[model samples]
Target chain A: MPNCDKVTALVSASLDHSLPLHKRLAVRLHFLICVWCQRYLTQVRFLREAVREHPERLESAESPSSTALSPGARERIGQALRDDRR
Target chain B: MAGNLSDPQTWLEQHGDYLYRCAMLRVRDATVAEEMVQETFLAALQAKDRFAGQSSERSWLVGIMKHKVVDHFRKSVREQPVSDVELMNDEFTGLFDKDGHWKIETTGPKEWMDPSSALDKAQFWQVLRRCLDGLPPRTSRVFALREIDDMPSEEICAAMKLTKSNLWVMLHRARTHLRSCLEQNYQGLTT
Candidate 1:
């Protein structure tokens, strides 16, 4: 039986659609036995659905290019064009 | 028009940007990456006859760029300090039991975690890149080739001259470091 901490995270991950098959079954079994984990899983499911249903913020924690490159890096690419020409 | 080797400058002009971009993506440093790109172009110009087109020109440049990045990191960054958290190698294996059962609970039959959202967060991406930077040079090289560059595991094994176990160990270490880093970043905040 997974304890509270592991159960909470598993529920969170499950709500996020991240739990793998075997682990998913184990979490389901635990949820059946433990009401706290079940509620936690419910909250997670609700929040994830809310997040999905709503339009995400432009700066939400999910953008690949959000980690902006240092300023001028893209502009600096033009330097390569000029330098290689000579 | 493309077969001539006497005009090395023309070849450099034609493909220099491609070479530099390949090196930059691998090394993540603009200045040193630029030097490596120049060297790759020079080397290719000298040995253009060796190009048998086993891969596309972009991929060939990437192969050469890989070697250059590895060589540069080995020569320079390998001696830097690696944190104790990152030094933990076998802990991620704790997720598996002696019988190969997964210890973590999963709610669904998902095989992969979509960390794309995690990457979207600027703070998370910063932490992730820092964690990657902390990996041992060779391990980071292999990990970057597989994860960031999207190279096949077999290609990484061949390119890095590592065994399958070695590859998995390196990847495990990379993930462990990144996960712990992200967890630490998340632990203090109420998000």
Candidate 2:
């Protein structure tokens, strides 16, 4: 339980990128000292990068136009479009 | 509540691809993804005045799309719900073995590096996609919400019905797993 509490403190800062400069400085210093935290930072960095890249190439791999929409569905959207104009 | 968002052509030109890409990552079906994107736009159009411009228009649109995805998942109940996922919790227990025993030290502030051209190219995305697809469905969904959706962890806890501790546990686990997978699979220089 105590350990969990310790991790909780770190989690928000990690997510927010909002640690105070000194604290941020301390974390970087620790990353330099600790292999585990260094690896942990690396993981955080990679996961963030992965998420950013997901949208870039998603359309090319799966083209929406290549999949056929039902005529009825198309008409509903078409009607919705017309209604929006009115 | 209605303005530029009411302008169909202007809205599409501004947000079409952004919404489409966000929707595709979650739904994984192009047609359904397109519908989700369209639905997001329409919903935003209806709620335009609520846009306080607090977050980027991209984040705002993705936030709506995320709720729609959550609803879709809840209704579909796919093969497994998040509770059914018996993820390995022991893996990261060491880092938090004792509260305040070992504080994280971030001194040098490791400079962020752009992935090399080779990694930025097709092979990188392929390796990454494969790794993401390899994650358990629930973990992947949580990871996507936190990382891809760019929603705050607190917001994720509320949306996913998870406690902050549980969310962190899952988040740490997911980040650790992704790190290992990307490092093992992709030849990223930093990883």
Candidate 3:
């Protein structure tokens, strides 16, 4: 059986769809009975999903900033725009 | 938030929040992100005369913000000397034996209690962002380009001047770090 390190690396690499056929088979074969690896894979998958759904993007023109813009920064931007127009 | 682009003050009020969020995710710094958004607005205002009715106003502004983010990264990578030693650590080495066999201590991942529910919380995203910020700048940038932005690997390599192997290594390390961070920080999500 491949070590946990090898399986873990391969599993993470597979997320990019970069593993070859034989290596894919090796990963699959390892997962068949390796409960620990399966759990690890689940953790990685959950992290990916959570990251994708994170409210960091400007979801739409309507969605406001997830974090409030600091007043100082807001003032700075305002001042910069005013100067540019002058 | 989509309307006339004539007023810069209105742009700052309506689109400022959204553009700030966009830049924050890419740069992971409030001051820098705010500056980038400010720069984006300046660029947009300057180019508004040339802004043919091609894309939406927000989209056009975002395109400029993306360029600003890329420029920030390029400058950051050039200014800071990232060490290779940190990238090639023996941290995960103990998980296996010399023969590359899983050691008895290498217990597999623990079942997450309720990952999706945890993700639904607003604080969960804050933690995730913090974890991402904790990553090395170059690694975080590559991960963002590939995962968050969904840029193609070929394009990432070309744009970042990274070889395929180097890109893969960066991604692997980023994933590894994020996974560990999430597991440690979030309840019901253990590795």
Cα lDDT tens digits for candidate 1, A25-55: 8888876766645644443343234323321
lDDT of 1 by residue, B20-112 (tens): 544544565557766776666655655567876667665565567667776665566533333444445455445445543344353221222
Better of 2 and 3 by TM-score: 3
What are the root-mean-square deviations of the candidates from the true structure over C-alphas?
10.9, 7.9, 4.8
Candidate 2 per-residue C-alpha lDDT over A11-86 given as tens digits, one digit per residue, 9 for 90 to 100: 4347744656766566656555455555456557655865566655532333333323345555555566557757
Fraction of the native A-B contacts that model 1 recovers? 0.01
Q: Estimate each model's TM-score.
A: 0.42, 0.55, 0.75
Provide backbone clash counts, one per model: 6, 11, 1
- Which regions of candidate 1 fall more than 4 Å away from where they truly are? A1-86, B1-34, B40-117, B186-190
- The candidate that wins on TM-score is 3
Q: Return the candidate ranking by DockQ, descending.
A: 3, 2, 1
Across A1-86, the per-residue lDDT of candidate 3 in tens digits comes to 66667788788778876778888888889888777777777877766665565534322212223366789988989999999989
Whole-model alpha-carbon lDDT for candidate 2: 0.58
- Tell me which residue pairs clash in candidate 3: A36-B108
Query: With candidate 2 superimposed using the best TM-score fit, by how many Å does residue B55's alpha carbon deviate from the native?
Result: 12
**Model-by-model lDDT, in order?**
0.51, 0.58, 0.71
Q: Any runs in candidate 2 off by more than 4 Å, and if so which?
A: A1-37, A49-86, B1-21, B27-35, B44-119, B188-191
Q: Is the docking of candidate 3 incorrect, acceptable, medium or high quality?
A: acceptable
State residue B19's C-alpha deviation in candidate 2, in Å: 4.2
Report the C-alpha displacement of residue B78, candidate 3, in angstroms. Answer: 4.4
Worst 10 residues of 2 chain A by lDDT: A58-67
